[model samples]
Target: MLNRVIEQFRLKVSSIDEVEDSHSSTVYKCNLSNGENVFLKIPFTKLKYQRELEAYEILKGSVPIPEMIDYWSGDEECPGAFLLSELKGNSLSTKAKPTIAFQVGVLQAKMHSIRPPAEKALSGIKNEFPNWSHFVEEQFYSFAEDVRDILDEHLYNKAIETFKRMKQELPSAVGPSFVHMDFRPANIIVDEEKVSGVIDFESVRFGSTEIDFTKLYRDFLSYDDSLYIAYQEGYNSIRPLIDLENVLPFYRFTDAFNSIGWCKRRGIENNALFLKENVVRLKKWLL
Candidate 1:
């Protein structure tokens, strides 16, 4: 079926090179037989093509997202999917540093500054980041089911317990600015070490600036604390840091819970490795 759709586009797929894979999609570098290169991202079952296409359309010129050239999606046969963009540059996050980190920080700040779209302008995409608390609350169900899959019993408990305590606290929230929900290093393509384009607006939501800001840590700095510090310095250079004390926990909850779900569906081996790593980072932040 996917092959049939590809044939409809008559795309000259050359060397189909694997680029990256996440919970929702897998990307390949499609060097076309016609000599042009296109990034082919096959959306997973969990992903909605309409959501991606809508988000990309709204963010087209507003952000440095890859412009959609064309897409194929419809009916149960296609299950509402698309393939339209690949930023032709290095993922800015492939190299982590004060420079790249700080630059990413500044670029994110610029993204946040774009004026909110008129409601009619974005009614097609679900713009409900204001309800992040509700979104986090839903994770509790997934969390309860995923405990046994977790390797480090101590850290696993820490994650569940922290999420519960944080939910109970329920602090007031902040800005619901235009956000690239998966605002991490892999989605950001770079040229000459400069951020060139933003990719994967699928997780796009209007939520706490903390959601976008903390990614500087998640994307590049989680494993690189020194770079995190540098990123902080760079981020601080551009704008005042929003008080993330309350929001980051929720952000971390969503991230960890999302991880568990991924493991549940995809084999737990690699997911366990990632869980061990990210759980440690989450614990460091909480501790």
Candidate 2:
């Protein structure tokens, strides 16, 4: 397959190494004969390929992200692949300093500020929901069904009640916006204490900006008040920060709930720790 990619793209490569952290895609770091470094990514599904490709088209100039150099929209024999310019950096660590958090916040705000493409221009992007709240509700119901057998009876009932409460009490979304549904430290790249780029946009979709903050908070902001404050400041510099005090708990709870369902789908054996953690969180929050 690599040889086929090389032949089809007419790429002159010096070296190629598989990137171990890629979960949803088979990724390779390739150093070209001309000394330019690039990444070759073959997404697991056509939907994922379309989402990432459309996300690049939307974010190219506005966000700090890798350049999409070349692509193959795959035929029956192979899945789609993208050759992307390497953004020189390391994945942002969970323990990164406040400065990087601030940059991440700014970049996130920039992403949210990008208006969705016109209705006719949506093409393959996943923007089917009428609104952000609708999207969240759909996510909860879908995942809830998936994990019905896995969750304890009492916990499942409590989760359904909590979802009802959230639906009734949560405020309307601030506005329609582009959300990076999987924003987290691992997807954020840092170079010399600054955010170099963000990657892994296969989960990108149209939703409220507030929905984007949950994972970042789970992984980074919850660890340090200073980082949270810095991130808020940076985001507010670009656009007004949402009132997290009221909305965060609901989003955070749903995030934990969805994670358990995700673990079930992906196999609890491989995600045992993650599954245990989220179950504990659900119990803590709901029971």
Candidate 3:
């Protein structure tokens, strides 16, 4: 397959090495014959490929993402692939310092502020929904079905009730702006203690700016007060930061809930700890 991709793209490579961090794609670092480096990514699904391609197109000049050098829209027999210019940096460490966190916040704010071209709005380059609450509700119901057998009856019922209340109480649509749904330290690139780039846009969508903050807060900002403060400072420099006090619980709960379903779909044994953690989180909130 790699040889086929190389032949299809007509790439001249000095060496090719696989990258291990991806969960849903086969990624390789290809050192070009011309002493340049590029990433070769073949996503597991056509949907993933489409989303990433559209995201790169939308974010080309606005965000510090890798350049889309070449692509192949695969047929039924093979999933598609992308050859992207290498962004020269390492993935941001989970335990990133306040300075790096601040830069990430700035970049995220920039992403949230982007509005797609008026024509493309209806063309469906992004995963657009009626509103933020509607998107969340749709996801909750879909994920609930996936985890119905895995979650105890009482817990599942409570979760359904909680989601209903959350839908009623939380704000509906803050902005139908660009959102990187899978924003996290692992997806961010850093160099010399500064955030240089962001990657893995297969989950990109058009939704509330608030939706983008949940994963980052859960994984990074919540760890330290100073980090949160610095992040907010950077975000506010670009635009006013949303008040998360009232909505954090709802978003965080749903994030954990969705993760359980993701684990079930991907494989329970391989993600047992992840599944158990999310279950514990749900119990802490609902039970």
Model 3 regions lying over 4 Å from their true place: 33-35, 121-124, 127-129
Worst 10 residues of 1 by lDDT: 119-128
Residues 1-287, candidate 3: write the lDDT tens digits.
Answer: 88889888999999999997687788999999999999999988888888888888888898899889999998776689999988878887667788887898899989988876676643325546465566678888899888897898999998889988886887656777888888877788888777878998777788788778888888789999889998999898898888887788888999989899989998999899989999999899996
lDDT of 3: 0.84
The per-prediction CA RMSD against the true structure, in angstroms, equals: 3.5, 1.8, 1.9
183: Cα error in model 1, Å: 1.9
> Which prediction has more favorable lDDT, 1 or 3?
3
The lDDT-based order of candidates, best leading, equals 2, 3, 1
TM-score of model 2 (CA atoms): 0.93
lDDT of 2 by residue, 1-287 (tens): 77887777789999999997676788999999999998999898888898898999889899989988899998886778999988878987767888887888899899888767785476557663466677788899899987787887888998999988976777767656888889988888898788998999888887777788898998888999989998998898899989987788898999999999998888889989989999898888887
lDDT against the true structure, per candidate, is 0.64, 0.85, 0.84
**TM-scores, each model vs. reference:** 0.80, 0.93, 0.93
Best-matching candidate per lDDT: 2
Q: Is candidate 1 or candidate 2 better by TM-score?
A: 2
Q: Rank by TM-score, descending?
A: 2, 3, 1
